[model samples]
Target: MKVVYLPGPKSPLEIREIQDPQPGADQILIAIHYAGLNHRDLWMKLGQYGGKKEDLVLGSDGSGIVKEVGSAVDKKWIGKKVFVHAAQDWGPDKNAQGKQFTILGNPRQGTFAEYLAIEAQYVYEIPAYLDLKNAAAIPLAGVTAFRALFTRARLKPGQKVLIRGVGAGTALFALQFAIAENCAVYVTSGQDHKIDQAIALGAKGGVNYKNENWSTTLQEMAGQFDVIVDSAAGSEFGKLIELCNPGGTIVNFGGTAGAITNITAQRIYWKQLNILGTTMGNNEDFQNMLGFLERKKLEPIIDKVFPMSHAEDAFKRMEKSEQFGKILLEIKS
Candidate 1:
């Protein structure tokens, strides 16, 4: 099997031929057809993420056909199309991930390879409405967005939603999910064209955060938002606080921009706002996300798909933040 291996922190990713893995007694061997890229992969490449950084396959999302099953697994799963849940050992807590939790890739083998032997419980049948390529885009970002909006923020239909940094995968998923729930969705992006793209995808409106008065412009255009989902936590985070409706909720899952600064305590207390932080979710969140995707038939927007041999180009695109949606790797087809 050919795998994309990160030799060490800040080192370039390389393709290496490695032995294929056989399923353990509780595992299923999947011949991965497609894999999705995330900022997590980019961060690992840049030595920014914690964990075993050297000698690892880097990918969190994937979809494929089950080629074989472990002795303890049901034979019925063989030949079924499925996607792998990106997180493992999320434990029993519904509100937070336990200490045993770890995302796919890094310390464990991941889906970037031609084959993946994952536990049977962590794999789900791909919905009949979606193909393997798009299913490859769903696991990580979709679950994170679902947990952030529905589980953490407790988003409601007909409410107003503001998704920050709209072009990224997770943010786009949040936008799509919120809109599906009948919420009026708005967005922010560094690029104006991405804002237009969001509008085309059913967002009510959007603004470019690069503008000096972007938040003010959004407030004037869309009024206050009931739920604000942000990944780029930075100096402008305070502006998000000001844009929230009283008693509204703000959920954050990443800090790509930098440390949050200039936020005032009084604004939050006065508004009785809920400020929550979340990460990759528990099993329940993943299951709910799958159900939502099946119910809504929501398709992920794929910006580009690179062949396994061109994995470096995929990482470069993510490094420059040039993508409008999920970037994928065509592993088998």
Candidate 2:
């Protein structure tokens, strides 16, 4: 098996030939066809995220065909095309992950390889309309977006929603799902072209946050949003608070822009705003996300696809924040 893994702390991801894994009694061995890249993988490469320092395959999303099934697993799964869930051991809590929770691409092997041996319960059949390449793009970002909007924020049809940062995979998925729900979706981006691209993808409109008075301009253009989904929560996070409608919900999945220093507690209480934090979704969220995509026949927005040999370039694209959607690596047949 060929794998792209981190060799040590602060190490560059490298491709190496490694032994293939066999499935356990309740596991399935998948021949991975595609793997999706996320910012978490880049953070792991830079020793920022807490992934294992040695022998770690660094990817969270993948789609493939089940080549073999373990003794305890039903044989029907063999030869089925499926996508692997990003989280493991989500435990019994639908509201939050339990103590045993662990995301893929860390201490355990992940999808950046030709083969993956994952727990049977974590595998889901790919939707009829999705090929392996696009199915690989959905697991991490799709579920995160689903949980953030529908689960955490409880977004409703016809509500006004704003997603901060329009180009990343998760944000793009949020925009798509919001459109599917018939919400009025707006977005912010540092690049004008990104904002324009977002509008083409069914956004009502968007603004470039690089403008000096972007927050004010956004307010004038879209008014206060009923829901705000953010990944970047730096000093500018206060602007998100200002953009929210009274009783609005704001969900944060990551703080890519660093720590927030300016959100006012008074405004939150005065407006009765709901500020929530969410990470990867639970099993139910994953199932619902896939079902929604299948029912809607939604295809993931793929920015670019790189071969496994060029996985480092894919990481570079993510580091530069240059992609408009999920960046994928073609692993193997």
Candidate 3:
């Protein structure tokens, strides 16, 4: 198998030949066809996120076909095309492979390889309606957005939601789901151009956070939003708190603009607001998200596609912070 692996933190990705993994009793081997590149993988590569030091393969989302199934696994799934779950639930055994939970590309080996072995149950059949290339883009970001809005916040149709960043993968989906539910959606982007992009994606309108006194402009639309979702919470964290209506919820999946920021206690207490944190969701959430995509035929915004051999270029493009959507690695079949 050919793999692009990080031998250590802050190290360059080394694409080379590696031994293929054998499936365990409840696991299966998959021939990876594509891998989705995310900023999270870069964070892990830089040791900013906690991942194992043992030659990590950096990717979270992937689409692949089953090559072989282990004993005790469903034979029906053999030869089926599937999307893989990035999360691993390996228990506390020092020698245990794949013991770490829900970690696909971080502390564990990821989908940058030509092949991978994972729990049979973690392999899900890609919706027949979806393109295989698109299925690779769905695992982490899709599941996270679905879990936060639907499970944690319970956003209802016709409600209002404000997103802190417009270009982020999850934020994009938040806007789409809001549109699907008939909710009024607003977003903020530091780059003035993303506001128009957000509008095209069905957001009612967006505010330009880069403009001087944009905070006051946003405040003008008072009591407008019932929910707020953000990955960029630098100085805007306080302003985002102010964007929400009373009893509104703020969903935080990540912080792209430095994690630590000041949020006034009065904002949380006086408004009776909620700040909910979400990570990659469970299997059920992934399944439900797939169902939604299958039914609605939703597509995650695609920023660019790089060949698997050009993984470094893909990472560089994502780090530029200018992409309009998900960056993908297009693997040769």
Candidate 4:
């Protein structure tokens, strides 16, 4: 097997030949076709992500064919096209993840390789509407967006929604899901072109947050949002609170900018806003996400695909925030 291995923090990614892995009793071996990159992978490369970092294969999203199954698994799975659920041991809780939960590509071997051995339970057959390339982009970002929008925010059709920092994969998913549900969707981005791209994808309108009065401009353009899906939480977070309609909900999943600061307590209390936090979801969320995609016939927006050998360039693109959608590694045909 040839794996993209990270030697250490700030180290260059190397493609190395290593021994193939055998599946455990409840596992299956997959001949990986493609892998998707996330901000988590970039953090892992910098040794900033929590958990063991060195000598790791870093990827959370993947799609491939089931090449072999362990003795306890059904042989019928062979040759099945599947995508791996990125999180493991999400346990019985539908509301939250359990103690044993861990994402792929950290302490555990991941999908950035020619093959991967994952628990059979975590592998789901790809929908007939999707190809392996797009399927590889959905597991992590899709589930997070689904859980944040539907599970945490309880967004409904006809409601007005805002997807903050709209260019990332998860934000784009939220925008698509909101539109599919018949909601009026808006977006914000630092780049003007990204805002236009969102508008092309069914967003009602958007504003570049780089402007000093971006939130005010958005409020005038689209009124107040009933629900806001956000990933970047920092100095600008307080502005989001002001943009929400009374009794509106804000569901946040990441703090990429930095610590949230200087939020006015009176605004939250007076408006009766709900501020909820979420992470990579449980099994139910993953299944629901897949079902939603299948039903809506949604396809992920792929910004670029690089060969496994050019993994460094892929990471560089992500590091520079140059990608407008999911970045993928072509692991195989």
Per the 3 Å backbone cut-off, how many clashing residue pairs does candidate 4 have?
A: 0
lDDT of each residue in 1-333, candidate 1, tens digit only? 999999998897899999999999999999999999999999999999999978989899999999999999999999999999988998887787789898999799888999999998899999999999999999999999999999999998899999999998999999999999999999999999999999999999999999999999999999999999999898889999999999999999999889999988999999999999999888889999989988888999999999999999999998898999999999997
Q: Give the TM-score of candidate 2.
A: 0.98
Off by over 4 Å in 3: 90-100, 221-223
Clash count, predicted structure 3: 5
Q: Which stretches of candidate 2 lie over 4 Å from their true place?
A: none
Q: What value does the lDDT take at residue 22 in candidate 4?
A: 97
Report the Cα RMSD per candidate.
0.8, 0.9, 3.6, 0.8
Q: Candidate 1 — which residues are off by over 4 angstroms?
A: none
Candidate 3 lDDT, tens digit per residue, 133-196?
A: 8888878888878888887888898898887778867778877777887888888887878889
**Weakest 10 consecutive residues of candidate 4 by summed lDDT:** 90-99
Which residue pairs come into collision in candidate 1? none
Q: Which pairs clash (backbone N, Cα, C closer than 3 Å) in model 4? A: none
Q: TM-score for each prediction?
A: 0.99, 0.98, 0.92, 0.99
Q: Over the full model, what C-alpha lDDT does candidate 4 score relative to the true structure?
A: 0.93
